[model samples]
Target: MADLPRILVITDRTQVRTTVENVVRAVCKEAGCTWVLLRDRDLPPLERRRMAQRLREVTNECKAKLSISSDAQLAADVGAEGVHLQRVSDIDGVRALLPKGWIGVSAHSVAEVRLAKEEGADYVTLSPIFPTESKPGYGPPLGLETIREASAIGIPIFALGGITPRSGFSCVEAGAYGFAVMGTVMRASSPGKVIRDYAAAFATSSSRA
Candidate 1:
């Protein structure tokens, strides 16, 4: 897998007042975001593929990477750099389908993270790191300590759920390789600024380290 970006922006068109394409363009072009995970699962397959293809063009124009969530076939069809799978997904199946492509898995616990690593996932998004209105049923926040623990398992961990620009450095300090944000950037009036802030936070953390 290629070196993963420091920020992974998950798209949710319903949460955005503006168009998803506009936000993605802003983040990729202005904020220098290198990775985008298309997560509009509620859309019909045809519609979702159309959206993915559109976003792929935007990302490609900005020299960024695009990953389709839970859809290896769509990722392949649209020439995405990766496929982000649900925890219950068959990693091997996706591997066979997209042999050279990146594979990211959603993991809620250290056990799941370890399992994902064992199954050859290139990275994992460990979610509910803080109280998130976006995924209330994910239960309580996993806290920074969990980030520390999960990162020790030897796979890159992207802190997810309720992650904000302000909290980016904290997750990095706790050993997270990056952050995965949805609602924060999706609902932002200036999505580029949010992405820039996240980059700034990571930069600050690196300087301190």
Candidate 2:
């Protein structure tokens, strides 16, 4: 809700959960990041719920929002900030499962962006502004032009996929509201420093506007 850079750091469940979660919480707290998207794929329902609960505890300490990628019901159960819907259909399902205050959607194209906005998403992730390893063979990356087009639709667009400290600011310049990074921050040798650099860049850009 502050006028700071909206940085959304995503957690990969494939990594060491406790270490990653702790590091991310620390980095976000220091950098004043807006939210952390906990993308735990394919875990059992109960385990996912537990992970969300733990993440909620850390995020609460940091005063940052935690958005779970799946299990909207579990997200609500654990008092998560929101749920990130991967598919369009999941949007309605999640909306119904979670409360009015908690819902986001992933958008790969302008159409999806419009649909997400129409579906009453809190924010939408528009991805592949650069080629990313996360979604192999998904399609060619939608460059900054697509992001500009989507952002013009008046919805808050979080640029995702292959976003790094170097490219993150450019995403904002291209009309994105923020940047969502997984490998860029999570896999960084010094995530704290990387987050600081990213925040600095976004702050500089914001000041020039």
Candidate 3:
């Protein structure tokens, strides 16, 4: 696969509908970060599908890939590009539910990452390269060394957790294939500019490397 973009914007419908979705979409578009993970833990099944469809419509306009979280069937039904499995156990089940071309799991630890790779995940997310607001009480952030170790496992690793526009480039420098964000963009004064800055920093680093 071509080098993925430096950012993956995750949208939780419960947390990111209304204004947040607009801001995130705008930011991801400007940054050329073309992958989004749409997640909503509170929505009813029907509502979740509806929201997924809406997200697909919005993301497609920017030519971004939309990956629904936890619901492979719904993702396929709504024409999403993939599904993000939160746990290793869900990997085979979700894979069997979707067709051949969709994306799969992202694990947080070395063992889980290995399992994800073994299970045929399209990519994996290793998190908390620094403290993050989205996941409180998830223990101290894993830091760059952990991310680098996980990245060496030979699967694409998207560094997640507490990754701000300022620290986003550090994740890339540490060998993360990309970064995934929730609060940084949602909480930004200008989400679009935040994305642009992160992307620019990653591009600059890429050129220097």
Best by TM-score: 1
lDDT of each: 0.91, 0.77, 0.75
- Estimate TM-scores for all models: 0.97, 0.89, 0.89
lDDT of 3 by residue, 1-209 (tens): 35455577887544443564586567767666687787666678887777788778878888888888888888888887788877767777776667564565766677877888877777888866677777787767888888778887788888888887677777888887877888777666677787787677577777989
1 against 2, candidate with superior TM-score: 1
Candidate 1, number of clashes: 0
Error of 3 at 110 (Å): 1.6
- Model 3 bad stretches (over 4 Å): 13-20
Give the winner by lDDT: 1 or 3: 1
Candidate 2, which segments miss by more than 4 Å at Cα? 1-5, 15-18
Model 1: pairs clashing at backbone N, Cα or C within 3 Å: none
**Ranking under lDDT, best-scoring first?**
1, 2, 3
Q: Largest lDDT belongs to which candidate?
A: 1
Where does candidate 1 stray beyond 4 Å? none
